[model samples]
Target: MLEPEHGLIRQVEHAHTKCWVCVLSCLLLASVYVGSLYVWRSSLPRDHPSVIKRRCASVLLVSALSPAAVKAWIHWADIRVDVSVWELMGVRLEGFVPALILPLLLTMVFYLGPLVHSAMDDPDGFTTELQSVLDVQSWRLCVRDVVWLRNQVVAPVTEELVFRGGMLPMLVPCAGPTAAIFVAPLFFGVAHLHHIIEQQRLQRDGMSVILLVAGMQFLYTTVFGAFTAFIFMRTGHIVGPVLCHSFCNSQGLPDIGFALQHRERTALLFSYLMGALLFLVLLFPLTDPFFYGAIPVCSLAPAPEPVC
Candidate 1:
């Protein structure tokens, strides 16, 4: 085989250097983000409106400034992609609706049985639930409620912007789409560890219990992070991840045990299996980048994989 060109070898060396910087910058970003919540000297529980609002302010600022991470990336003289941070962060207008709709719809399909169960458990009855959907007062109350707004909108948007939008751009160019999906989420997972501090402060649980819960949370969030990262890579747009994040926050995790114990176990079990099967079956097809238009970020991939 012929020797590689000197310029090609030097370019590869520069890319390696940039990847190292990305790794460090991502860790620093996660540290500052998680650190922000504790900066307030509040004695109140995390769920307290005042505390929630302050933390919200802290995180949103971090997200708004997250583009700075890209500046760190381009510090390497000849290695950077010369793309805007917003576009690198998957903020393009192409494939807007499908990015908004299909991934969230796919997640809901995975939670079909649990969501139906949740709706069925609404004691106010279907009519009341329907009315509530159309109720301006209810909408206003949700808007006014800091916790509701944080959960349904602010957290999802900010977290996705930071973990997916901000972090993925740095990581994709370095690790490529497949590896970045798994790698970037570890920061997302570790950033969630701050929850243990709040729970411990409240004395709501013993040390062991808090640690155990935090560990489990880390696992779950990391797995979810990978899924959102996967969606981000495939669509190369932040909208899908944000919508899916918001829906998952609203639904919580699927209550597999509750479904197992329900009176309609037969039908519910069928749904549980079928929904999962369908989700797995459609995961690739529904998320095809061709359907969403050309994904700009796939340029960072080492090779053109199907999802990209």
Candidate 2:
């Protein structure tokens, strides 16, 4: 019964409402994330057991809170919350494996040259380091690294829940899938800038180094956010991005120092880089939803009627 102009106005208002919800949800989550870190750092010794427990609790609290808040907002706004956890968190083989592997493979390729050079140049040292990593005692220390815990497991779950699971669906109503994919990641990228503040507090690094490091982090995290958003949209599940994030954190970034020093290593690095590029070129086709038979990602709003 509504006229065309009235319908357009309604759509605009709906989009604006959804956008506001997404922004406010992200802001609330970011505040909790950074605030918890500051509080823990201030209250306890850096390595204290209480700090670890508190960090885990804070992450869990915020992760749980964000989704609940979103659901409540949706219901209160008279919007349907039809997205399921399975749709948000399911792990199908086709979608999950590639999602997990591609980033890891790219990371390995990035480090391939340096790793090969290290093995050849200092075989004993390399073997010793490998052995140490594999050693039970070393694993115990790794388990104790709160930062590792946060990055590998906690952050993946909570961030995916907040950003991909919560925010992206809300965004789909307002922005469509393409815009949602790109826009939600901006918040993700900004959320990570808090790392710079944390680093400055802990390290007495010169301003130049701090700024450079922070800049690179912001760039990479933003790019990775976009990538994760894409994966979430394609696979229609939070699990895809969560696994990818965890694997990425485990692999960390490649150290290319050896490639700079040796010609052979340089060639190897170039080859790996080329391979990574090829993989990226193929990423979309390989991850197509039809190929995976993934559940269709439900939108937050009903689609408009088609015109004759």
Best by lDDT: 1
Error of 2 at 137 (Å): 8.9
Looking at model 1, residue 108 earns an lDDT score of: 84
Q: Give the clashing pairs for model 1.
A: none
Model 1, 226-294: lDDT tens digits are 999999998889999998998899879888898888887888878888888989998987788876887
lDDT accuracy of residue 210 in candidate 2 = 88
lDDT of 2 by residue, 1-308 (tens): 66998999998897677667756766676677657766664634445667766877887887777756666656645566555434533334545655565544544544455566667678998898889866999778878878777778888998887777767766666666777778888878877777677567777687789888888887888888887787777666567678778867865665666456665765767755765676667666655666445444444434631100
User: For all the candidates, what are their Cα RMSDs to the real structure?
Assistant: 2.4, 4.7
What lDDT score goes with residue 295 in model 1?
Answer: 74
- The number of clashing residue pairs in model 1 is 0
Cα distance off (Å), candidate 1, residue 130: 4.7
